[model samples]
Target: MTKINVETLTYTQLAKVFDHAILKPEQTTKDVEQGCKLAIKYDAKSVCVKPCDVKQAADILKGSSVLVGTVISFPHGNSPTTAKVAEALQAVEDGAIELDVVINIGHLKSGLYDECQKELEAIIKTCKAKRSDVIFKIIFENAYLSKDEIVQACKIAEAAGAEFVKTSTGFASSGATYDDIELMRASVSDHIQVKASGGIKSLDQVITFLQKGATRCGSSSTDKILEEFKQKNSA
Candidate 1:
């Protein structure tokens, strides 16, 4: 694998790779607005906020190129498939440009790969049909999976036509690790993008994951990470 020097990435480039996430239900509209402002200020790719705030985020980011993203099935993937699909559709209708849906972990654990695949496919199909421009990301919550299971999940995600396979939901026991990122990268063909979410708390961690093949990042600490980069570069 080619080595990536995190220190060398430009501030703008780093910003483009971040998905400023605010998943907490308690987050107020002001909090969501602050997140949108930070994303726009830094030119981040998108701001991942709760589904309820998609329209608000979209309105805040209007005329800007930043995309709005929200979660379906959220931190837990135990929601019924129909509910997940409904959430995805509703979010898009509310102006979400990206939908990150959690894969059903219990189904996967039970070896019901087909059921899991169908659920993801249903949501993907609905999103695509409703709005061809919307992007779909499937979160696998890798903390609970074995290496082989992770690989299988990626394969299923690819088969179901998800644009990205994300690791963890930040509510899981663990977050994205170098090994897990590499494993995911190796598992899927180059056509699919990999997003690293969960415990990324610093610029170094983000750079490490990007080097390991993560195309995007999901973290609530996007502002802190970008601040660190600016300070380091200024020094």
Candidate 2:
């Protein structure tokens, strides 16, 4: 959990909790560039770009504190394990410092636990072998999962060596809800932090998630959120 207190949170500290979302499929090169500039301007923790945008985002964030990140297997994680690893290898080579991957929810729900665990292990082992410092987050896409399923997923994530367990892909039927965030936090061990994603738009929403034990958020509204943080903290 982050040590930042709500009452004393600064815009800078708030910025560090954000993985500025640049994941829209419609985003052009110019859009990614603008997003990268925004991350740099706010000193955001990272620019969570599309896989194809990793190189560009990395170049833009080069020499800055902001990390360059991209999604693996993306909103739907139906790809074969080998395919995901190959995609991740290229993204890391393109300079991604972090990778958020969607687990094979179908496999998990189908009770194919061994297959799911093997896939996660392969992906994590492959990525870490190449980039030891890279932060790997597993997205549970919690909208489709029951509370017990969420806990099982978190356990799988920890056993497979993930650094964080995330909720939602935003492309889902619903986004990050407070109850889901709290439940995820309560279920995971301290070694595995929680990230609340999908539809996290405002400062109050971000703060609410943080108070519930999320360490980071993925958002397209980085500017609006931080500006509000600045104002509220100063007020």
Candidate 3:
């Protein structure tokens, strides 16, 4: 599909940009099934599920356009590179079409930039070799990083062949912000899309991020956000 202006998008168009999130620790298998149902109802781009729940989501959304996605080394990203890779491959085997793996935050904060870059490259290299069509989105968990750190992280992700550079894991102390989205957009080339996750619950926030160059957003309030967009159109 051709790229259109996210700023001037209609409600239906906006709905397609969301990756409906069901990653909360307390969410159950039934909750994931319900989330997949909602993603299909809203025409969402994908349903973000836990790694273990990939097969379940894939089975539920098999005939729908909504893709199955899962996180690896999530929220903290402290897992070793090999562990992350293994988790990613297992997710693919379980039927995940997209993988959002967190970057090693500790490595970045400790100035092990090379280590950080290598971790990403290792995952990207193997995942691509295994499944070339899989979407590899690298999450930075940016609330803990300075502007410079965020920039370096984006650079590393882009260099390592990430399809998108994400702002937060939504499990952090803070989430996506307008400034962070803009900075991330400016930091990377056009080929590397931006995904704003964590606390993006309002329609205005979603529009603001899209207008600022975010290609997609992660939201738990998927139905509410699209309903808000609908209300905006009718208003």
Candidate 4:
């Protein structure tokens, strides 16, 4: 659970909870650069970029407090375990310190728990082998999942040694909801954090999620959200 009180949250405290997103397929090099700048400007925890942009994002964020994060298997999670490992290793080698990996949604929906667990384990083990400090987050893309599936996914994420279990890929039909945050937070142990991603906009939303026990959020609206916070708090 988040130890910070939302009512008394400071700007820097709130800023650290965001993983500024630059993962849109249509985004270009310019977008990644701009995103990194925004993250640095706001002192965000990290810039969650597409796998291809990890190197550039890392270069831009170097020497800054902001970390480089990338997605694996992306919005879709149909990649084979080996392929996921390869993709993750490349991103890590490119200086990504955080990896948000999509689970095999189809496999989970089909009740193939073992397959999902194995894949997650393989990716985590392979990446950690390279960088023991690399943070691993498992993305459930929760919009497509049932409540039971979400709970099960949380358990599997913990079992697979994930540091966080995220709500969505931000490419889904729906994003993080209050109920999902509550459910996920309850579903996982304290060692595993809950990250509410997708459709999270505004200062109120960020505060609400953090209050509900989420440690992080993935958002493309980093500027808007932080600007709103700044304006409100300065008043």
Which candidate should be chosen as best, given lDDT against the real structure? 4
Instruction: Give lDDT tens digits, candidate 3, residues 1-235.
Output: 2344434687667888999999999999999999999999999999889998999999999999999999999879999988999999999989998999899998898999888888899998898888988998899998899999999999999988899999999988999988999899999998889999999888878877888889899999999988877776777
Candidate 4 residues lying further than 4 Å off, grouped into runs, are 1-6
Q: Where does candidate 2 stray beyond 4 Å?
A: 1-6
Looking at candidate 4, what is the lDDT of residue 89? 98
Which runs in model 1 stand beyond 4 Å of their true positions?
none
TM-score of 3: 0.96
Candidate 2 backbone overlaps, count: 0
Q: Report RMSD for candidate 2.
A: 1.5
**In candidate 4, what are the lDDT values of residues 93-119, reduced to their tens digit?**
999999999999999999999889989
| Residue 142, candidate 2: alpha-carbon lDDT | 91
Candidate 2 lDDT by residue in tens digits, 112-182 = 87787789899889888998998889998998998888888888888888899999888999988888888
lDDT scores of the candidates, listed in order: 0.90, 0.89, 0.90, 0.92
Residue clash pairs of candidate 3: none
